[model samples]
Target: MSAAIPPADESLYAPLQAAAWRLGHLGQSLDGFIGTAGGRADAINGPENLDHLHRLRALADAVVVGAGTVVADDPRLTVRRVAGDNPVRVVVDPRGALLPDHRVFQDGAAPTLQASLEPGPAPGRAERLVVARRDGALALDDLFAQLAARGLRRIFVEGGGQTVSRCLAAGLLDRLQLCLAPLLLGGGRRGLAVPEAASMAEALRAPCRTYAMGADVLFDFDLSV
Candidate 1:
């Protein structure tokens, strides 16, 4: 049976219209795991959450994901479930591990950009975007600047945990949307892996609002404040 589609909440996504906005999203189980230890996460979220992700992609000027996500999910990163144009697809592959066969590289459904640490020919129809590395990680500032240079100011970081964690830790994301499913996985990949804080005072406490997406609950955090 097809899952119920939730109604769109305009107020929930009003912050995305801000100038130079950046939003990150992740859907995980109630127990705080995005996938199983063996890398199985085909159905972590319901159809309503998937529709929400497609809506974000449709609104974004560019949708970004880490190489790990592409390798695991092989997502096309297009706005198929909603009525909007597709955004530019970006993949962060600092190590240049992805091949030419990945769907995002060859789909040709939307313009694709491969952000890497070294300059090289892009695979398939994608373009190469050489980025700098800071502390052995892709420099988020440089990536954002490069994207902005191409008029991609409204960014969406749709991820596999590590990439979203990096943006959150760097304070680059203006907002974050975390959807929690009702299922519980005892042990698996974490949804968010930000750096550990030594004390409760060091923890991040942003103002947030919650919405019901069918059986899943979405927590929309306003981080720009």
Candidate 2:
């Protein structure tokens, strides 16, 4: 494990600080206003986030994302974070809708594990986790328990908005680190889109510290459960 995040408890059965759930907005303002690229507006959190994720990835055994994110971004979930062992890329596809050739499972970046409702006789040339679910939502609690048992105890829940919201509302997240971009969408997709925050202030809960990334203010919410 990386010597970065310390354990929050002793037993470590409950979940140690070794794991972190990174929830950030992929916005222009948030990027330009806070996290900058080479002293300029960082339209995204830039390498700062990549670096943070890297630290988390080094300690974590698996990195996860919702299928929507895969379809939308088609990200190649690899650990360019600072180099250690390459973490396993896990995708959540309840109905196996990731479209066989999205490039997320190609190129041999790392082993891509697909957890779906059906086995389908193939793990898409990667790894397969034929999990059962009721409403297509993978039994989150059970999945996490199994992941922990599989040595993926320190897990990172990287995501799409809905996925992040669901995981947090379920109280399954241990910590949430968000890098707030400066630009305001006013109406674009929100970086953090979940249930209605009781109020704006309540929504952007206090005790939440803010840091200046580049042009955006990094709002890190410590959702340590």
Candidate 3:
């Protein structure tokens, strides 16, 4: 995903909406978060992030989530406001629980590709890819290589926490974007993973960048190059 910097990096212009999305999500919310405590909208789902996220949809080659994410979020995964073409949609539905009846499979824009370990093809027009794996999840290396072959640069790995944390723990993440909302969930759920690590440095280390958007702060993780 490396490239020469465009002159408009510091500001967003009308034509470069997609570019803006990629740069903006450089440090986005942790997992999924949105809105403030006192707001009418409440939940882990943050509607505030949607505007810029549209830009990200245009820039990414694919928007990926684990099946758990798809079932929980059921995101349309489209670029509603951005200028560029929509990215491909991918779901790591290892066991194929994300049925065709889901709205996601119904979207025809970029098309939804399910990367699973299931034996047969999924019904309907939804594409099925059998990824090699021991457990239900696809092998990370195989998944990325296939994506690369399809020219899916700057793939966005959205998540259900476990998948995102897996990418982090295996050092497969190129960048990490986290959004911090002002209010605390306290007992609901954490935004990132707390996998057992050998050391504190290992736990916290990544290439770093930061920025602000509305009431949220974003963190860009730079994994070792």
Candidate 4:
């Protein structure tokens, strides 16, 4: 319904120009937890961060998420907090584990697509794109290829931890915008779990910039390096 993203917020996502740019984000606690052990994730960031999220969604061609996020949040994945057109919703549900009646599938605000291993009936109005399985898992390369073929570039990979972790581990993420809240979740879901560094020399390092968004601190990393 809206025409374009606001200029102020647009400045936050100017790096996403290419068709294959994959930017990921997660709202984590001080202890690096994205959600509780039982998959409960509520508002961790304040107004500014939420607006930032909507702006990111507005600029993206598609918003990608895993089946776990779909099942846990049932988010509409639309640009509602700001004025902009909603992006296409992409669900990486290789096993078709997400519920058919989820709100993401029911919402008619944006075009929805599900990438799965087995071709079957799509939930609601979503179109199913069968991604061939590799080693009994969905091949990230093939999935992105298919999405690119469909003209979906500038993807926003928003998360549950597993999805973000997989993308981070696979080196598929171009940029990472992490909003860290002050709260602490001592025994909750991790923000990211990748291969451990053997030593300080083998650690992953990248240029990062920080910003204060209300009560949260946003860290923007150039993961492409």
Task: Give all candidate RMSDs, comma-separated.
Answer: 3.5, 6.1, 5.6, 1.8
- Give the per-residue Cα lDDT of candidate 2 at 100: 74
82-166: candidate 1 lDDT, tens digit per residue: 7788899999999777999999999899999999999988989999999999999899889999999999999999997989999
lDDT of 2 by residue, 148-217 (tens): 7677766777776566666776667755666665455444333445567677776645345555545545
CA deviation > 4 Å runs, candidate 3: 1-48, 197-201
lDDT of 4 by residue, 1-225 (tens): 543545654545567645568988999999988888776676777888888888788878889999988877788899988788899999999987677898878878899999899999999989898998888889877888888888887788998788888888878898988899999989777887878899999997789888888889998999877
Q: Ten-residue segment with the worst summed lDDT in candidate 4?
A: 2-11
> Where does candidate 1 have its weakest 10-residue lDDT segment?
1-10
- Give the distance in Å from residue 119's predicted Cα in candidate 4 to where it truly belongs: 0.6
Residue 144 C-alpha lDDT in model 4: 82
TM-score of 4: 0.93
Off by over 4 Å in 1: 1-8
- Ranking, lDDT, top scorer first: 1, 4, 3, 2
Worst 10 residues of 3 by lDDT: 19-28
What is the TM-score of candidate 1? 0.94
Pairs with steric clashes in candidate 1:
none
lDDT score of residue 6 within candidate 4: 51
Candidate 4: which stretches are off by over 4 Å? 1-11
Q: Please, what are the lDDT tens digits per residue for candidate 3 over residues 113-201?
A: 88888667773557887778845456866776787777775677766566777666566666666766555543433335656779877
Candidate 2 Cα errors over 4 Å, as ranges: 1-43, 197-207
lDDT of 1 at 192: 95
